[model samples]
Target: MTDIRRIWFGSMSKTLREAPLTTPNARKGLREGVHWRGVSAEVHLGYRKGKRVGRWLVRWRLPDGRYKQDGLGAADDGLAADGVETLNFEQAKSKAARYVEQERQKQQDAGKAPIPTVREVVEAYAAGRKARAMKQEGARPDDAKGRLSQHVLSHPVAAKRLDVLTDEDLADWREGLGAELAVSTVRRIVNDFRAALNGLPARTLKRLPATYPMTVKLGLKVGEAEPAAARDGAALPDADIRRIIDAAKAVDKAEEWNGDLFLMVLVLAATGARFSQVSRMLVGDVQPVQSRLMVPTSRKGRGQKRSTHIATRVGADVIESLRPSIAGRRSADPLLERWRHRQEKAKPGARPEWVRDSRGPWKSPTEITRPWAAIIEKAGLPVDTVPYALRHSSIVRCLRAALPVRLVAQLHDTSDKMIERHYASAIVNALDDLTAAAVVPLVDAERGTVVSLRG
Candidate 1:
């Protein structure tokens, strides 16, 4: 029993004659019998001047600081409670709770503001997001708006009342999404919808049923092994990685690209940092003394964007190759910058084009596509091979090498849970390799062992 109920029972005498409101004498001695708090209502026993029985009364406190009162059945005094004509303390509290909920529902129906629908909640959330993002520069509020418009705004569930939404309704919608969308995409949609529900106004949220689906209940994992195809498809062999690096150097030399392509590709392979992160690196970020590279993270999610760096260990050869890029450069200068090429109309009314070229830091990943394509062609890699494949290969290499998952996650700037979630098969294989030594034969004839060694 709960502590409050325990106190109610423990405080009473065993004989029941002296227990609170159990006997005729106990009921007549007091003006009011006893009271206890329910969820949002309170139940009290009403006593008469000379009767052995009392009536159960419930009081509901409203938002306007007013209390609404109602009568339940008679409190069990001389007879046992059947939950109909008479009620025990526990039954009375339960009945009062149900009554309060019904009254609240009635008030909601009659109020000026109607109960919120899925569409309303999602739109409000998107609007609020945009308003908040306006106060903080660079925040992308349209992400939520775009997702909701595509997945929810046109769906049937969007018109349904939030409080009446069933689990099956949500499950059906999620299952339907799996037919046309990737598992990761469905998971993102569900998470975004849940965030919208949570972002609703406090009054609207209070009206939602407690059992509403606020999270994806079905298996949203990419697959049984979870994204194994994507992981396997993106990763390359160690030999291929070496070939790519060599090809990058050769392409830079042949194309007169100023070694920027080779160095950028080298840093990406060695550190496994994203293109955005690598683009933000400065000369001081290259720690040749420690043989490490301090790469900045992209901080993709909500909240204040703070500059965070992950110190990734690299080989001495990588550090040596990076020194030439950093040599004679200011500490704050971009580590890998090159001349930018652009074209503009020669005049407002003329169709002729003018070359507008200047040198500065790399502003976009598309800037490297030309050099990357040449490198891929030189290495004889697949036409579909992307720069991000290098990151996948780097992570797989670390896992196959049996590096600790925690350390690998640190180097990749992600959580161990994320690592396991995305690379379950790789992690399982690594575990198998780690535990291979624990397997021993039960019998050893060469040692002349006899009988069982088991305990």
Candidate 2:
């Protein structure tokens, strides 16, 4: 019943004497005892060194009558180094069947159907975004590439073929990422991935997967009560603000401090400008006569320049104080000089010098982070308080002063909706002030019964 001529025992011939021994077929490279035939492939069973060896060696005949042989995999039992189950005889047979089915399907699929992977789609989307960004003035090329690198390309699901991707696969990926990343961050990344996949052209792939399942939630469900408020920095209290300002002034007077640290903090509080926006401000951007400061186009502005009025008297004072330093400087010179550490020599033990540096009116804001942190620590402020808190404090103060939300939004170059969402507490305080100022309490002469009235 078995083919003895197709089996070769090799070194196990003496040990496997009870089993059938035969010569290998030079044409097929197949040594076999019993070869099982699938619809279009064959699985060979044999022996080597007295141990049973098997493999799925596909032998299919094309329409032209020529035969093609493909060695699928080893059919013997073994464990992979990663501990995943290796293909056994039965599994190999199943794989052989699937391979043949895939081949048949490929023939029906027009012979050249492209099966692009998730990685390919992500790459294509990133490239398209980069090209579009390059066309726009002041657009950073690395922004698109960074989003892909951080959110989509590094994901394990990126290796999966697009045609076979399922909602379950995406859900699993989200679940895994949820373990390491914040839920909001995970949601954003997942949405970005979905957007990238959906943005792929129809001709590039067969079909896109379903939408992402989990919506971003800021609060826990009924059974789970965890603080889920979106933590986007806080408005510094007036006491903390005063303390920080004092500390910055003290640091400015220090021997090692080479730049105007106090002015930076004062500018952020007075104008509600981002660190980068303030750092990039030129000496010419300050208009003391008009009482206005021109904030250049930033990434947040989508590259459109905007102007903010100097709303506070203290702000005017701060600008006037800095005018003398920038008097002899060109309009293209930076209004504020940033400090950098320079070594006297290239040697490792050389003493460092603190030098002021500027780039054609643009001073880098990152240079101030270390000194700002030290000042914050020395001021007895919260360790978590950041430089951006100064802007938040300015916004809250403006809102609490009963300034119109639209006007405040215009001053910050942001939307009223953003102010309402981020400074709701300040809005409430302003409302309280309005009620106190407008409403009057009436008292009866005898009983002292009070009634609040408003015109």
Candidate 3:
């Protein structure tokens, strides 16, 4: 038999404190609200719609043999509850008792509040994530905001309240996204939206269909198709790479673009570094004496905030070409720089008006795309080839040279797992020659026959 006295607290703070009602996890298995015996009524600590702060309600037995209930205040779950507005367990019980004593006389009832919409939740989630990212060392908060704004906030389902949102509604919206976006892009958007939903109250989250709330057990199905980078046209041949570099030099020389496109393309190929990483390199990052270039850590993905560099060795001739950029310049000077310009409206064939001379580091990777298109065109490469192909080609070159996967990963500033995942074909080709040395000739000594197994 269970002790009724142990289940209910009466004028005792210790009883309320010791009960499994303090933490969210502890109260998860309990009913909607945990009750305690209060003066002339029962004090109930009610959990909210989501994992938000708990609320307090007082239930009284009326003389007509009916129960009357009214909300008192919020329970102190996350924030410390003050006696008047927010109340602790003991304070809540006392307040509930007081409210019941007064309310039982008048028989008053509390009205229900409005529920939050999906858009509201997503906005709050984005703001909180952005703020935390600003404080954290290496978090990409802008990416989070971008995903939510472009996908969730713009969707029709954002207007639907959590209480009314159904599995079908979520599926409709997700499918709509898939219709316009790539499989990989749709997957990322769905993931980001799911992360935003995690901030909702536990109860509301539970109300969502187990499979459709983007939970792994019952989530939306995304295709596991091979990445575009794994295709045959992803990487350029070594002959094409050389031609591209030569063509870049020709374009820069003829167009008088100050060798910016040429140097940028050279460093990108030599280091196998991303455009963003190479654009951030300083004059001091180029070590002429050591024939190496130090690429900085990327700000795109999640990692530790580091000032360290990934040292990549290049040819002596490559280092020689970089020496002129370092001549009589500060170590902090950008290695590859260009003259910044604004498109001023010119009167029919007339020279454009003057703007400020701002020679600084490249602000974005998009700045190089136009020049890269021209370089590729001059090199007679495919029109569809992107600058990212250089990174793929570089990784393939190292794999072709029989460099260890771990060593290649270190130089390229990515994981061996990623390299293996994207470049397995290149890896298999490298292994074929390496495994050839271990092969031994077969002998037929038992049959007293001399035959070559090499055949």
Q: Which consecutive 10 residues in model 2 have the weakest lDDT in total?
A: 212-221
Q: What is the C-alpha local distance difference test score of each model?
A: 0.72, 0.60, 0.72
Worst 10 residues of 1 by lDDT: 1-10
Tens digits of per-residue lDDT, candidate 2, 1-455, equal 33233322332321112222232222134444434333322223233321354444555545554545566655443333221133544455555555555565456556565677878877887788778766754333345567668756777888987645655666566655536766655555655666676676665533322221121111111122333442224887788888987888888778355446777777777778777667766778777777666765355634554443223334567667677757887887777664554444445776666444532322445566787888888898878788888878878878888999988787776778788877777888788999899965478668877755566
Candidate 1's C-alpha runs over 4 A off are: 1-117, 120-144, 159-169, 175-178, 201-204, 207-233, 250-257, 297-307, 328-330, 338-342, 347-371, 418-455
- TM-score, cand. 1 vs. native: 0.60
Can you write out model 1's per-residue Cα lDDT over 67-91, one digit (the tens) per residue? 5778878877777889878887667
lDDT of 3 by residue, 1-455 (tens): 11133223333323322235545455455555444343432434433423555676666656554556777777666667667787766686666655554454233322433456789888988898778767744233366778878877888989987655655677777777747676777877777777666677775554444432544223344557646457324888989989999999999998777878789899998888987788878999988888989998776557685656898899997898888888999998888898887767889989989654678776667787888889989999889999888998989889988999999887888888888888889899989979987786566779877776553
Q: In candidate 1, how many Å is residue 222 off?
A: 11
Candidate 3, residue 81: Cα displacement in angstroms equals 42
Error of 3 at 408 (Å): 1.6
lDDT of 2: 0.60
Better of 1 and 3 by TM-score: 3
**Mind sharing the TM-score for model 3?**
0.65
Could you tell me how far off, in angstroms, the CA of residue 28 lies in candidate 1 after the best superposition? 41
Off by over 4 Å in 2: 1-115, 123-154, 198-233, 255-257, 301-314, 339-365, 445-455
